[model samples]
Target: GKNALLLACMRGDLVEVQRLLQSDKADELFFVDSSSQNTVFHFACKEGHTEVVKELLRDNRCSPASAGLFRVTPFSIACEAGHVDTVKVLMDDNRVSVDC
Candidate 1:
């Protein structure tokens, strides 16, 4: 069920995501997808799941600045995808560098 957390983030299932985060497999949040090299935070931002994004941000393990393919950060991905709400949430996080 390692990938389940990623899928939950992709689907914006806040409840499932929350459950997974509390499980012993919570470390799954730090696993970058091998194919895309993107974190669960990236998927949440890309989908513009504002609540999901918020929940993920609550976890210190969730790296907001982690770059995926082509050096794309979750913030950059959100901006590129025109996910304004996601972008706003990232902006509010001190870990996310707006200057990037």
Candidate 2:
């Protein structure tokens, strides 16, 4: 299921993340956990997986502003977890708003 993507991101598995991203599943990109509602991007950011975060963000389907459980955004989670590299990668995206 789409949960695979989230798990891969959480584990910082770049190879798996890349493999999954190549598949034709748009829904996977937006896949959210049942409890946390965290997307692949959210988990990747939270875990400080800079490469995974970069790969996820490169996907046009990835939503940098997407909010998860508790209305937490990927950027916010990254910052909260002190993922400096992840935050920097996200900030590099012009779509990310630090104000949020």
Candidate 3:
């Protein structure tokens, strides 16, 4: 399960993501990938996975602004990647800071 969640987010697998979220181990949602220090939110945001992003955001534990290996926030990545919808979803979250 090391990268299972990360992979699912990258592929935009909403169903698999939902199922994963229901598991007791769902807290792994914030597990940073070894290579990138990127969480599921990071991958989902960069790839423009709107549904996946929403699902990840539903969990209060997930942080939209979590930094990657070099301290790059998922919000910034989503903007750079042109994921308007994903960015919007993140922006709407009161937990995420647009200025950060």
User: Which candidate has the highest lDDT of all?
Assistant: 1
Instruction: Report model 3's TM-score to 2 decimal places.
Output: 0.89
Model 2 residue 73 distance off true place after TM-score fit, in angstroms: 0.6
Q: What are the models' TM-scores? A: 0.93, 0.88, 0.89
lDDT of 3 by residue, 1-100 (tens): 5667888899999999988888888875568878888888888888999999999888887888678888888899999999898888888988887895
What TM-score would candidate 2 get against the native?
0.88
Which residue ranges in model 1 land beyond 4 Å of their true spot?
none
CA displacement after TM-score superposition, residue 63 of candidate 3 (Å): 1.5
Question: Which residue runs does candidate 2 get wrong by more than 4 Å?
Answer: none
Error of 2 at 49 (Å): 0.1
lDDT of 2 by residue, 4-89 (tens): 78888989999988888888874645677778887778888989999998888788888888888889999999999999988988
**Cα lDDT for residue 40, candidate 3:** 82
Candidate numbers, best lDDT first, in rank order: 1, 3, 2
By TM-score: ranked, best first: 1, 3, 2
| Tens digits of per-residue lDDT for model 1, 1-100 | 4488888899999999999999997894569988788898998999999999999999888899998998889999899899998898899999998876
The RMSD (Cα, Å) of candidate 3 is: 1.7
lDDT of 3: 0.85
